[model samples]
Target: MSAELTRLAERVADLERRLSATTRTARLAYSSIEDGAIEVYDNDGTLRGSIGVQPDGTVGMVAVNAPPPPAPAPALVDSALAGLDVSWDGQWANDEDTTPLDLALVQVHMTALADEELSEETMVAALVPGGGRTGVATGTYEPMWIILVAVNTSGVAGPPSAPVQGQARRAASDDILNGAITDLQLAEAAVTEAALAAAAVGKTAIQDGAISTPHMVANSIQGDRIAVGTLDGDRITARSITGSQVIAQSLTANELAANSVTALQLAAGIVDATHIKAGSLTAGLLAADAINGKVITGSRLQTAATGRRVVVDPERAEVSIYSGIAEEMQPGGLHADVLDLGASKQAGVSLSAPSLGKGTAYLAMQSPNTTGGAGSIRLEPSDRITEPGYTYLLARQGNSTTQELIESYASAPSGGKITVQQQTSAGFTWRTGTTSATLRDGVLSVPNIAVGTARVTPVADKPTSFRVAKRLEGKEVRAFVTASTTVPGTVVEVAATDADNTGFTLWVTRTNATATNVWWLMIGSDA
Candidate 1:
């Protein structure tokens, strides 16, 4: 029996070892479940916890019991409760004559104490209700303990409630009531453009005619906002549309009414060349003195009808006129006003009028009247055929005054010749080099004459002569014997005679036969 018991024990031990090894292998093969929840159950088979997806599709651990979570603290009420009221009697009144005192009017004083400790010095007094989570008006935002006490009608204070700790904060959106805020409650500039939502302000929000020039910002009312046919002449104030208000190039002929714009309505210098349409302005459209003081700037002022133009070139500082004459007319044509040209120094005025060989080109200065005063002085081309390139100056000093004529002719490749004549008694004077010659009252007086010396061989006791290089007709000839090679102290005398235009004779009288030098002078008029 002992041997059998021993064998049986060994078998039991072997079975135990095998069972242990099988359990470990099963654990290693199935370490975790592929799907399904990992649930924990209590001894009674009640699910205590789970690590799996909940019904709301969230994967998290769930505590099924959670020990019934300690009873929750009382929630704060978001409203004020009614205050307790006490019945009171006036001073010296009987018991029947009692009055009910409203505790709300009795002023419940609330004090907010500092978080560190509660003291009188740290308490801020504010009037508030006691019950139903009433708030204490506190200036500070720090966490603090608030205590409240009710005052009786007799001004006696009641016992204070237990202090509650809280923090002062801004009222949330839920604390505000609908339509509680009004215009009077809003701060200045509190409602800005960004504060309004898109399309928040509708047409009904604005009153009729409430917006004025002061209220609307500049250029705020765009064209898209204005309804068609809404803005018209009657809607706009007179003279209110200034140049700055109008868009550039926006106003066309169709946009303007006839006679709508006038000088008074236009600003000074606002109308420029770009503003005016071509051929839009005419002589009749302008006032007679419209441009009197105004400056007209352009390249030229031209007449379309006559092809006359006056060009002013500012870069060159020059002015030129074409196909026209410039005349300054005075009232009644009797004023002695002078036409001034080239007022600046070194300035020149050129008057050129070519005849193209069809007529004469002359410069004439005439009197104002044809019948009186000094008549005219005319300088014109000479009419003499022999000197086609000659010019003459004729001065007619009226009917009572003498007329003077001066003629100038040029000989090709040589020099020029000038002739002067007086038609009356009055003559003129001419200066050449250091000598001056005057012709007056039909008499010519020359300060210097042509005097020359010539040697002549005289026949024995006879006259001898030589031809004068210059014509001596209509002249006085004077001859004198300067020296003689004849016998010394032989008494020689010279006489000028037979003086014609071409030649002259000089007679030498000497007692001996010898040559004599005679000096002769001739004074006459050049005709």
Candidate 2:
């Protein structure tokens, strides 16, 4: 058996060598070879079916198939806009021609970033380290490929645009676009393209100036427009503002006295001092006509007991300068940040609203009721504020603008009026839990909290935990802008709502010692 196996192996080797040496290239139309074997050896080579005899022996060759045609190169898509600068005025409409349907444009202004800095390709590639079991198993992607996701909401509501990169955006309320490069091949193309485009013309513009002069505008037009080289020098005029006119936007000075150009305007002649000479010079507004109305000769002003202003004779002892308002409600001219609601033009008297009467507040008292002046009053937005004479005053305790509604209930243990106390930072101290400490002005009054905000819900029935009043604060930190600003302990608020007269509900967030979400508590009004 071993001898036969040796002979077979020798024969196979010989056959393979002959085939390797033999190469046939035959073409004569009619004669074609199929499933044939060739064997070559020394001049004593064995021939089976066909044989060729020649004087110098037959030179062997094999027919070689032509190489498959090469595939066409990928076409490059040329983009239209490379560099752009666009400006618009107050009034602008959609330009159907230039607006993109699915293409996303990322813009970086000169004030924000540069052009080359806008491209984010090489950076992203460097981040993706590639290698595998083999040396370069996960070969680097081609540099030219760019990836993108595009979606459209044009048919649904808003304009449809493809996102160049990942960015959250909102266009029209209903429009949305969703597109993505789902394949690696596509991503390579898209992302690279985007990087090139952004690098071409990267940054946007920075606004140079808000208001330029007439000299800056060359074209001549009527309203506020000036020809270049035409406008010169600044126009300065003296003006006075009074009454509840917002001082921030109005009066340059609180009160105009000597050298006070309050009463002078466009007449422009370098005149100084507007002397108070007559009835009710209550810091009145000086319009074009008012500046022309009064003419004064001297600087000194005098006042009589009848509240009338007269030219100072310098001999009279009544030229008193009665400064600003002096409050009667509180000393030091301060009263719990009182809101002005009066029409009296009396200087040295901080006015309070006794219900200002309409035009009467402006001129002499006309109507017996109603008034118009700047005043502070809390506002609560509602759709069910239906009571004929009731208007809710909104109060907030924390940084959030939302004022939640809380209802409270209490019952006498022995048939006495129910009273509740407010807890402060130092815990329950004197009068801290007493009703009188909170009561004010003969009513069930609220305490003057640093963050003074609350809504009183008159009780019908006491809650199950009657003694359990809340100490309010936040689980997570939230600020309260009181008169100015205060710390965590400064905030406190109460709110309540009633649908049926029978009962009400209360909602509040009770905080614990630690400022974390763990202590956030919600309680409702039982009464």
Query: How much lDDT does each candidate structure score?
Result: 0.50, 0.27
* lDDT score for candidate 2 against the true structure: 0.27
Where in model 1 is the C-alpha error above 4 Å?
A: 1-267, 276-299, 302-345, 357-387, 392-407, 410-416, 419-428, 431-437, 440-443, 446-527
Report the C-alpha lDDT of model 2 over 350-411, residue by residue, as the tens digit: 21221212111111111111222212223322212332322233221221111222212222
Clashes of each: 0, 39
TM-score of candidate 1 relative to the true fold:
0.24
lDDT of 1 by residue, 48-139 (tens): 56676554567766655222111111223122221111111112112342223433322222234432443333334434322233343433
